[model samples]
Target chain A: MKKLINSAESLTADALAGMAAAHPDLRIDPRTHVISRADAPVPGKVGVVSGGGAGHEPLHGGYVGRGMLDAAVVGEVFTSPTPDRILAALRAADSGRGVLQIVKNYTGDTLNFAMAAELAEDLGIAVRTVVVDDDAATGTPDGTPGRSAGRRGTGATVFVERVCGALAEQGADLTAVADAGARVNAATRSIAIALTACTVPAVGRAGFELPDDRIEFGVGIHGEPGLRTEPLRPASEIVQDALAVLLDQLPPGDDDRTIVMVNGLGATPLLELYVVLNEASAVLRKAGLTVAHTLVGNYVTALDMAGVSLTVCRADERTLGLWNTPVNTPALRWGC
Target chain B: MKKLINSAESLTADALAGMAAAHPDLRIDPRTHVISRADAPVPGKVGVVSGGGAGHEPLHGGYVGRGMLDAAVVGEVFTSPTPDRILAALRAADSGRGVLQIVKNYTGDTLNFAMAAELAEDLGIAVRTVVVDDDAATGTPDGTPGRSAGRRGTGATVFVERVCGALAEQGADLTAVADAGARVNAATRSIAIALTACTVPAVGRAGFELPDDRIEFGVGIHGEPGLRTEPLRPASEIVQDALAVLLDQLPPGDDDRTIVMVNGLGATPLLELYVVLNEASAVLRKAGLTVAHTLVGNYVTALDMAGVSLTVCRADERTLGLWNTPVNTPALRWGC
Candidate 1:
């Protein structure tokens, strides 16, 4: 792999060191790989924390700041953080009001975060968990081997974190914050298409190989195999296909409002992400759904895969209010 | 080439449409491809404007807003914008206070922007220009073939835009804003190494081929041939070599403060960029220089090339203060 790293073993640690050095506001523990706000445990405020694999940067760690996440527990690339590490983040972020854990739908991440929540409860801390399963591509109508896994969590995790984080920062109780997160998760859906596969640093090879003339549809964030492979098509067509699937799965009413996010899976250019957003917005507007807000860029990524994901959230008054609330994290900073 | 573009001809327009849709706060002109603040001609503030090829996104367009440039003139990918387009931006951005043009040191960009400034002056709008040439790799000694070209402008353009934009927003006259931009440009130097080649959409192929086990040293932002090719090395060593060249070209005094920016060229991951920043910060500190600030990420990009560039700006009190000033734009928004 032609990566700008020292070695596979030191990738996470080195990146953490860099993150700590770059962001003085974040306090990164060397041992546990937990990144938390420097001034944590804010009195009377519910702590908000999230984590998953490491490759999808600006995700958990980048969201750890004043108006977003209080802490982020990081793991190796495409690997879930250990339960012990998650527990450390919980302990560090607990501020007396309570703590809310935002876990993705990945099996390992779900189980580990659940365990940490249990451990926090064991210590008499009020902890609530919200599992996000927003990926429409992973939806199995019925009887399937991995149907129990549910839809794999994807880019809408940012929406969950942002809305929930804003609510928690506003002194919302743990239950309210958790409910908001669940609400956002339920209203959001995402679908991704990859033009190229990404190589894991440790493995030094791509998880899968894609022919130059073809593209992978509904690819997961971790370079997982998508639903199927098809011949490459124009950006407008690709976006239309993704939108068809997303809208079919989560149809918005005529009076409903929507927030659109066109996320790039690392290596995709912002220029192209905008193209995808342009088409996606047009499609939504033509469908008579009010496109309230739009976000375009590489918010969540799969290492260095060349792909883009379109996420549509059917926002109500409350969800829109929470999303519009000011956030000042590294990745999603605005309205402050 | 695997890219998310509709066609080479429609790339710029499509991306601009997307940018306009994504950032409702910014105004985009479809005719001339000019992205400007929605509320331009800010009565008393001097107008700051910059532009170039379209590939290096979030540069000119993304940096247009409240405290940054009042307008950005976008050209085709890797191609200089026409003089008429530049003039349109200048006219749109100019208030009674006059306009300041921030042009990079490319022959085409310089000539075109200069022509635009001349046209704006004839149209009764006062204009000042700041030409940035901060790339250390293309530097020539006393007697060389292209010594008159000075240096190729690279990542330091962001520093120029930020400092000068802040100054302009403070209601500095055109001359003062131009002077600040020139100072930032004069004090900055950058060097980059590319691990892969980037394919321009129009070309449908990479500018050049790079061997798997080797890297192109001192590569230009436009994929211009570097000084030489060398065997791939560790990130630390690559950073050290680039820093040696940068410092050797623009050495710091004993009591100088510096702002280091580790920029990614398109496809490089933020995780690796921070890895580079980690080492770059260490080297600056060990040199006994005060590292006042650091910006990391893909501020300046070369399509989708996997490479990193290190930019060091030797700053004094005034420049440092200006850097700390709050500016809110699409790409570089913080401290607001």
Candidate 2:
């Protein structure tokens, strides 16, 4: 129960200040804990805004830049950003093209972002909101499959957030942007595994206890325990377990094109992710589906959990192409 | 030494296969270990390629998409990608426009990418290379800030990799791209702090040890030891200590604009990063340097080490603008 910090209460503020010092290209509105590119309000572009609790680095804040998100409103560690702060971010990211809010499906996130969108509309700024409900297994207690993960967005949300942001940057109107987001939500499915528990800075203890040589499947980003626990298996078997659940949640299809994402839950290495990808791909192929794209990395991490997640998106040509579009954020960049 | 895996020898290969399955858009050239977007050779775009070892997730491989890098070559573990793999990535990303290689400034990365560029030239493809040497505190064993490491690349490489990739994606020529990369490398300086050691999967043991209430400053990504070990200080003091080393490495000036980055080595939470950021900004402002932009997240990660790193870049209008450019990859997305 030890960490590097001055005081438990001062953790979030101190970290935000460090971020401002580290990345000069990002405009850190410390007052609101919102991050936007220094040269925000790009002429004629639809401003894209996204946020959630802290702990999931590079997801909301790190994705702030040109192609991904215009502004990211961060909450306290694993806590939702207050409505006022979210509104402020919406206000800042807004342009004549309008603003789109990428909200994870978590209860607090949805409520706050929804309120912020309403507030933006009250200000005569057109705003649309998309709630990422990509976590197929949500709201369920630990060790349950097909049970809801209680609003956990998981890795699939990364696609929902970034793809929507990308389209917004391309000047897509709020409706189109929201529709694109919904399209991804409808197509994407995620299942995560956790090898170790994370420790919230304030808490100063492991989020959960995982027996050595054991792993959990279908864990949430906020250390929400997990769906089930089992003995550690080969990377392939772990991939199978996660992918089985994900594929089952996806629309039944044979030969349908899908985008496969092998995401590390923070601590897992690229090699492990690749191994998970191999097994996940085999599952997809065995199910008679074609994997049109493969993305393996730490997209939506859960601190240092040392595990991986599999996300399968049933993508069409447009969604796939947009996935190919360029985005310049700290954690990801390429196709722009 | 307690890791959950069936075998360590087959880790990399198995992980690659899993990644291919999960993200179908990524084309995994297994033999070459070069990952590319399935729809590569995007019409009318200059191709950009990057690569290195397998441990760094979302780096060269995760970055291969629409906007950021056109392709990425992968190697085993922390080792550099082979010249042949780089050549394959260049060819895959090539769209008749010249190819640019964005390389980190490690010895292995430099030599391998250099050789690959020559090989690409021999193949009659226009290829250029830009190496990023952002670390200001050099000569640290393990290429980290100190010893007790096994080849660490602190997350600061994100600055050079993403910035360079963003420029290249915008159709910047090889020379311009390389120049921009070099500029960032020259302006940026990074230092890290570690709380606990990370164990490479193959090694199966922690790289180093720290007392329950102690902190190690100037640590590296690969679980390297640190330059200074002291009683675990407040997050504020940690930020100050890192800034002391990083700023000292940079050219002193009150007039220069700076970009701040607080990077997590892997396991450190977002809350801690913000804590570190808070203190860093105070110190920077006191130094009379205006903070321009900021990026805080897990950019370059060590293998789930409990640590964080700080990167400060002297930025101007040009660098800041480039940082905002659109990039499309699994991890980052900006201008769509």
Candidate 3:
């Protein structure tokens, strides 16, 4: 394993320290790696918090800011944040309205964030939890949707958290915010493709291996190898393969009420994201799926892995409106 | 050359189609690849616009939302968004309050966005432009601050767009918003390192070669190689090397007014980011440069290349306030 670092075990701590030094907008409790903006615990605003392992860049920590999350708890690479750290973030983010935790559908993350919420509740802070099982490819073997994606939260989690964060920041009740988040999660599904594997710093080397010119379809975000491997095909066909599964899972609707997310698996470039979006739109149009909105970029990524993930969320007027709400974080901002 | 897509030529189009088919909250003008929210041109708000190549994911496009950019224009991989495409986004984003064009330092992006701004002006729409040139290390080989980084905007551009977008959405005049963005660019400086090479789809292989257990310091975002090669070092030492150059160039300050951005070069994970941040902060603190804000993530990537970058911005009260303001995008969001 060839990497540049002082020590593998110390990588996470060292990295967090540098992050604190570099970004002034984020207040880093390096002791816990819980990242909040400089002026956290906004007066009277319900705080929204999310977090998980460290490999996924800008997901948990990068999303800490105004229109989105109030704080983010970061763990080591591919490791879930500890309950203590999460509790710290909750303590910081908790405001008069309440606090909501957006937990991804991962075993570790769910357990830790849920426990932290319980702890917060014990402290008399109103706390709510929403688990995002947005991966359509979860619960299945490696080939079919929900078979082999490995309990993935995929893309809509980012959207869900932002929408929920916006609602909470607007002083919505915890239940209302949690309900909105759950609804959004239920309306979303995702699938991914991988051309290459990522090298975890500690583990040094590609996480997995694929034959040249082969593609692993429906992979998880943490460098878990995908479900099926096949010879490489045109970008259009790849989109079709992923969309065929997604379309079948989505509610049949011509209602122009859906959001599209084309996420790069770590290393895929934006040009490829555009292709994915273009092909995805064409597939949806052919399948009578109406795309009401679109996002193309690296939302959830496997460290340096080369590929893309497609996430589709069925949006109602309310969800769409919430999607337009403002949020402040390191990774995303716009609607508020 | 180990990518999974069948062909490089159709990568962008196919990906866009896939995204459109999957998500409902996002829309793509299939013809133009401009990504917008489901309900664009929101009432009573100025439209914020930004665009560039497709390589940088979740940037201009992912950032298009209510509190951030109103619309994002995407070009081919590592290529500039065409004038026509940018003009389409400008038209889509126009809400009568005027539009702000937040462009990176690249010549291509600057030229294209500038042209689009001109075209919008010709059409009687108010337009403002801010060029981001935050890279410090690659700035001229002759030691000039703005010559060697190939006109790359790097991560600070994200800050420019977000704050400018916020002010624009808040009904700040084009000039005020542009001035704010320009100030951010002026205060910010960035430097990067690369551990390996990235494969551009068109190139179908690593953009450059690096020996095992080696890292190239001062690499450009587009994989333009690096200024120097060194044996791979630990996170602390790596951060030291990068911070050494970056801090040397920054104006001295012991004041509590600095924004630090520790960015992951494509393949580096968040754990490593924190480690890098640790060393960077120590260096900055020793230099009497107090960190008031910070962001650590894959803000500006170089495909799947493994490495990291550092960006430091001296902040004043207004800049700090602006940084804390709300932003809503697919990537970064925060205080609204």
Best by lDDT: 1
Compose the digit string of candidate 3's lDDT tens values, residues B200-276. 88988888888887788888888875668888876677777777777666555435568887776666656566677
In model 2, state the lDDT of residue A171: 74
For DockQ, the strongest prediction is 1
Off by over 4 Å in 1: A140-148, A251-255, B140-148, B251-254
Writing each residue's lDDT as its tens digit, candidate 1 over B44-141 gives: 88999999998987787989987789999999999999999999999888988999988888999999999998999999999998888888888853
Candidate 2 lands at a TM-score of 0.73
**In candidate 3, what are the lDDT values of residues A146-262, reduced to their tens digit?**
443245676877888878877876778778988989888877888888888777877877888888878888777886655578888877788898888766666554266678888
Query: What's the true lDDT of residue B270 in model 1?
Result: 83
State fnat for each of the candidate structures.
0.63, 0.69, 0.64
Could you give the candidate ranking by lDDT, starting with the highest?
A: 1, 3, 2
The residue ranges of model 3 lying beyond 4 angstroms of the native Cα positions read A2-6, A18-28, A32-49, A64-72, A82-101, A109-129, A140-152, A166-177, A251-256, B2-6, B10-189, B247-261, B291-300, B312-336
Candidate 2 lDDT over B1-336, as tens digits, reads 434344777666666666665566679876888888888876667787888876666566767776567788878767788888888888998888778787776778888889888998888888877666555445342234332322233454566667776776677776787787767776777888888887777887778888888877777566555677888877777778778777776755434688787766666666567677777888888877777777666567666677777888887777778777766565566665
Q: What is candidate 1's CA lDDT for residue A82?
A: 95
Using all chains and alpha carbons, the TM-scores for the candidates as numbered come to: 0.98, 0.73, 0.74
What's the TM for chain B in candidate 1? 0.97
The DockQ of predicted model 2 stands at: 0.39
